[model samples]
Structure formats: C-alpha cells, structure tokens
Target: MKKHGVISFGEAFIDYISKDRSNTKFTQLLGGATVNVIAGTRRLGIPSYYLCRLGVDESSLFVEKELAREKVKTEYCVRTPSKKICRVYVYLNEQGERTFHSYINPTPDEWLLESELQRDLFENAKIFYFGSGTLFHETARGTTDRALKYAKESGLLRAFDTNIRLKRWESDEQCRETILSILQEVDLVKMAEEELLFVTETSSLEAGLEKLSGLKIPFLLVTRGSKGTYAIRSGSGIFVPAVKVNAIDTTGAGDAFMAAILFGFHEKGIPENLSQLEKYTQFANEIAALSTTEIGALTALTNLQEKVQIFKWF
Candidate 1:
C-alpha cells in the first residue's frame, strides 16, 4: 500500500515574539501558521512538505535548516532576491492572548508561478493545506487562488485553516469575500470560536457550525479555547474538552492543534471513513495544551514520545 502525505502551501517567516512580563526581551523563531502546522504534523511522525517563498537571508536559511531537520521536504520553497525575511513581532497580554506587530516584506507571491511550483511534489501529495493570510495580497492571492483551483480540480483533499489575522486583511468585508470564495474549494476547515463568530456574524457555535456546514465543507473543526473543541462531518458533531494547562503564551497553540489533528487523521488513513474526529480532537487539544506549557510554538512538539508519555500521566 502507498503511504499518504500532506503538502502545505503558504508563507514561511520569522516570529519575533516577546515572552517577558516587563517586555525586556524578544525571541525570533521560524513560524507561519501553515509552516507551523507542517512542523507540528512532522513531529507527530507524519510526512509533509512546506511550499512557500522566503528571502535569501540568514533567517530564511534558518527556516530551511529547521524544516529539513524536522524531516519535512522543502523542494517547493523558493528563495527570492529580496533584502531580508518577513517577520511578525508578537505581544502577549496578561491573559496570554497574542497581538502581532508585522514587518511586511516585498517578496512577491508571483514567485510561486506555475514555472516555479513543483508540480510533481503537489501531484504526489494527498492533501493541500493553506490559510487566509496568503490570500490578503494580490500577488500571493493570485498565486494561492490558482494553486487552490488546481488542487480542487486535481481531486486532492484540501484543508483550510481560516487563520484570519484582521490586520493583514484590507477590510472585514474583503476578508469575508476572499475567505468565503476559497472555502468553496476546501474539503476541510479548522477555525477558532472567535474567528467563527467574526466570519459568520453568528453569536453561537452551533449556529456558526451550521452556517459553515451549509457551505458543504466535509470536515469542520472548531476550537473553543478552554471550553474544549468541536468537529463536525455531514452534520454529525463531536466535541472534546480542552486539556488543562497553565498557558504561558497562546501564540502557536492553534497551529499545534491544527497539526495534531491532521497528523491524527493522516495516521488513521481515510478522513471520510474515520468517525474518530472526537478522538483526534482530544489528542490535538492535549498537544495544544502542552504547547502552551512553554513559550515557543514548536517547543513541546519536538519530543513526541516524551510528550505522549507525559499525556499518559496526565
């Protein structure tokens, strides 16, 4: 039997996130929602690839090294002639909520034109993953849109993490339109409770899930933070409570959650045949909880066997 793998499409950049109460020091880590998911999935022993562009700077080189170390293929990542790598500075509130300060680079997403895209890489992938921020700019928007169209038409399983960073978008209306348009092409969507409320303009999770389900999405995962998480398929809903953990920084928890779920499903085989969304959600929530036990997003995911051992003790 042939093995299954996922190909993630989106941006790869550095996150200059602060971890102190006095705001004394900031740390730079290789991060992007899509890349983080790929990394997290890899940590769970899943084979995946990150397809994106980065500057030919030291930071970009570090990202390449890290992805390679994680055993994730990077044949589709492009190195640009740009000045430096893109970075997002993160600020954490008292409640561990995250805020971003971004340095928008000039690397054009047109760099991902069909000439550069690894057709063989994508053609061999079982899943194609991306998020909304990649659709914010015209250059990236055009490239990702085309890639998504191709993925949908190619009969690949499409996953969308509706990672709506309001600051990156032109307007709420524009964000809705672009995201809604892309959702139609996606086979799965993972969204947070707040994002669901914001995107659907619904005050309740049930109503919000119903609205998203009406779009004909096959699998929908909704994370409700401390309250737990939910997954629905063809109107069948499954809920899993969040793992208890003292969160130091909540920045990458969602990415960890997304990756764990994908990893779980990938490990299990068929997404449509698996009625174990609840089990995956429970496992993913534990991964996300463990992620917040430390600062960096990818911290706890590194030692999966150890982490699973710890979870067993929990």
Candidate 2:
C-alpha cells in the first residue's frame, strides 16, 4: 500500500455558471483547480490535504462544509476575516465549451502563510502539487514559493499544472515569466495544447517539445480535449484518445484529468519505461473523459470496476 498522500496549495473559489448570458439562473459550483483536484483525490480514497484561504462569508462557510463532506483534511485551510470571496462566472457555448468572466477578490490567500506548514505533510507524501495561479500575486505567491521550496529541499515529487488563465495576469509576458519560474521546480508538468504553445512561444507541437526538452522535466503530459492526451518523457511520445462521452459541462475536466493521472500513476506503480508511460496516459485520459459525463466536478467518477471495463474498449 502507498502510505503517502498529496498536499496541494492554491485558491478555492465559487463559480457562477450560466448557459444564457442574460439569465440569473446560473448554477453555483466550487471553482478552483487546486480544490477540484483535492476533491477528486478524496473521492479516490487518497489521503489528501489542501492549503488555501477563504473569507468569513457564506461562500466560505459553504465551501468549508463541502470540503468536510468530501473527506479532505482541512487542517491547513485558513479562514480569515475578509469581506469578499474569490469568484468567477462561467459561460458555456452550445458545444459544451466554456469561457469565463471573472471577479477576483482583492484579498490575499497569504493569511495562512505564517502558520507552520507541517514539513511531515510533504516529507512523507508521494507528491506535492502546485500551480501558476497561486503565483499570480505577491502575497500568495510568496507563501507558495516558500512551501514548494521546502518540499523540493526535502526530495519530494513535485508536480505542477501550468493552468494558464490569461485574464488573471497583467500580460502574457508576466504569465510566461512566472510559469517558467515554477517549471524549474516541477518533476511533472501538465499542460494543454494552447498552453504548451504559449509557454514555449512556439507555433508547433514539435517546436514546443524541442524547447521543453532542455527543461528535462521527468514527465510531460499535454491534454488535447476530445482528441485525447499526449505524454512525452525524454525521447518518446505517445497519444491517448479521449473516451466518448456526452459532456454536460467542461468545468473541472482538466483537474479531474490530473487527479486521475495521479491516481493511475500511484495505482500502476509509476514507471520510467516509455511504454509504461504511454499505457498510463491512456488510462488517465479515460478517467478524465468519463468525468465530463456528469454536471459537477468529482461527482461522477468511474469506479475501479468501471475503469477496468473501459480499458477493454481502449
């Protein structure tokens, strides 16, 4: 049995999603990539913890309640006296695609920075996951930087999701600089096609791979929605097509994908062989595609039996 767990650091926000832009009947769901990943981990019975801040408001209260219900350890979650909560408005198209209009809270997520992060949390864990959004600001960025530095020094497996939300940053230049800095510390890097292009400043996938080859990240997983996921390490690349599902909402699919990838990595005993890596990516893509079948994130996970059944189709 794997005795370790995962510790994640990022934001926890509320998403207001609507099909019609003029309607007030929007569905309210939790909307932070880190939080969503933690939820998925909990559903898989993984011992996981999240470190983030929430305000003293109804949204915060609800989020706390939901986190507890999901069985994720909240010992590191900080509840501060801010009047606002991080928020986003998601708009979906007819094709189940999504675009967002965000309302960012001016408050910082660094309120938990002073709390002594239990070094044991990362020291004994199998993976330490972080992302770029937490580094978009100074206060939270400082906190995340310090924690990840600690995790790195302790020789923990560091995973980074280059979750690029262009609207959150001041400019593309700022995003590139901050994301590139985080890449230096990550053992595994997860990105989408557009993100790969943007991060590498290259027009083609081959060029992007060439640029990242110098980084020597142990594992690079690039997700191309619907078409499938691609995995490359050192010299080999493998493509895994997405499972066919009638997607209700694309929200949290990427987070679900990453969580499933982690689960598969743990369950299959992560291997260094190129063939083993390809096999894992195929399984991971199936889990991600299955997630989009339901409305909310992490609610409709494919169980062990279901996962086994799907592998036959692949």
Candidate 3:
C-alpha cells in the first residue's frame, strides 16, 4: 500500500457565479485549484490534504466548514488575524464557458508569506501540488518556492499546474518567466491547449511539445476540453478522447482531471504499465466531463451518486 498522502497549495476562495450578466443573483461555491483538486481526490478515495492560509472572515469560515464537510485534511491550513479570503465572480456563457471578474483588489490569497508555510507537512506526502496562482505575487512566490524546495528535498513528487489566469499577471512575459521557473521543479506537468500555447509561445501543439521536450517531466498532459486529454511520456504522445457528458458548467473540470490522475499515482505510483496510463487518462477524462454536469465545482462530485460515477468510468 502507498503510505503517503498528497499536499496541495494554491488559491482557496469563494466563487460567485451567475448565468445572467445582470449579476442580480449569484450562487456561491468554493473555488480554487487547490481546494478542487483535494476535494476531487478525496472523493476518488485518495488521502489528500490542503495547505493554504485563510482569514477569520466570513468567507474563510465558510471554507473551513466546507473542508470539514468534504473531509479534506487541513492540518497545515493557516488562520490568521485580519486577513480576508479571496473571492471572484464568474460568468458562465450559454456554451458552459467561463469569464472571471474580480470585484476586490488586493486578493489576500496572493499575499501568502514564506513564514506561513509548514515544511513538516512535506514529510508525510507522496506528492506536492502547486500552480500558477502561487507564482503571481512576490510573497506567495517565495512561499511556494520554499514549500516546493522542501518537497523536492524530501523526495516527494512535485505536480505543477500551468492553469493560466491572465488577469492575475501584469504581462505575458512575466507569466512565461514564472511558469518556466516552476517547470524546473515539477515532475508532473498539466496544462490545457491554450496554456501550452501561451507558456511555450507556440502557435501549434507540435511546436509547444517541442518547447517542453527539454523540461523532461515524467508526465506531461495537455487537456483539449471536448476533444480529450493528451499525455506525453518517455518521448511518446498519446491522445485520449473525453467521455460524452452533458456539461452545464465547465468550472473545476481540469482540477477534477488532475485529481483523478493523482489518485492513480497515489494508488499505484506512476504508471509502469503503458495500458494503465491510458486507463487512468480515460478515467480522469470521464470525471472531468461529468464535473461539468453541475453548476458548482464541488457539487458535481459531492454526492454519493456522483462519487460512485467516478469509479464507473473504469
């Protein structure tokens, strides 16, 4: 049995989503790559922990309650005085696509300091997951780098998500620079088609793959939404199509996919079986496609039926 758990660090906040642009009524849901991944992992029966600091504010309190409800371990989560949780308003179009609008400035989640991290948490994990959100600000970058370095020293597999948010960064160049920096520390790298293009500054998939060839990550996945997920390992690329599902909202689908892949790793370590990788990839794609059948991120897989559906893919 795998004796280790997974630790993920990044943004944790509330997402206020609405279908109408009028913004009169909104449904609030916990939104963050970190939270979504852990939530999805736990639903898939993987031992997962979340590591992020929150304030004593109402939003933070809500997150606390939700984490408890989801049974996500929070031993490394920080709650400090006078801090506020980050919140974003997401608008969903008719096609289930999303657009983010930040109502508030100074997103507290971006100010995570190096002093706030718990290095001891790295000792008990098999994987450490971090993302582009952690690299946006100076303080959070310092903290993310420290935690990643500690995870590296402790021999934990590092998972990197290049899920790009254009609004978070000042320029495309800065985004590329930070992503390249994080790439050096990651063993497993995940991105969508657009992310691959922007990060590699390439117009085509082959060109993007060529750019990433030097990074030599053990597993590199590029998700192409409806088309499917593409995986590259040992210089070989495999394309797996997504499971057909009626999607209502596209939020958190990528996180769900990534979490399922991590669940595979935690269950049996990295794929030694070429066929096993395909199985896991298809399973993840199913989970992701099913995730869009609901309005909120966590709600898609929060119920027992949804959880059961996750295993049915395989």
The best candidate by TM-score is 3
Winner by lDDT: 3
Error of 2 at 210 (Å): 0.6
Give the per-residue lDDT digits (tens) of candidate 2, residues 68-117.
88787888776667635677777766665667656767664344573446
Candidate 1 positional error at 254, Å: 0.7
lDDT of each: 0.77, 0.77, 0.81
lDDT of 3 by residue, 1-314 (tens): 33488888876878887757665578878878888998888887767888887778788889988888788888777777767777778775666566765555444444657787776778767888888988888888888889988998988889988989888798999999999878877888889999999989999999999998898877888999999988887668889998888888787899999988888777767877557677778878978888899877757775545644555454
- Give stretches of model 1 more than 4 Å off: 1-3, 18-25, 91-102, 106-111, 272-275, 306-314
Model 3 spans with C-alpha error above 4 angstroms? 19-22, 91-99, 105-110, 303-314
TM-score of each: 0.88, 0.89, 0.90
Better model by TM-score, 2 or 3? Answer: 3
Whole-model lDDT, model 3: 0.81
Q: Local error of candidate 1 at 34, Å?
A: 1.1
Tell me the TM-score of model 3.
Answer: 0.90
**What value does the lDDT take at residue 113 in candidate 2?**
70
Number of clashes recorded per candidate: 0, 0, 0
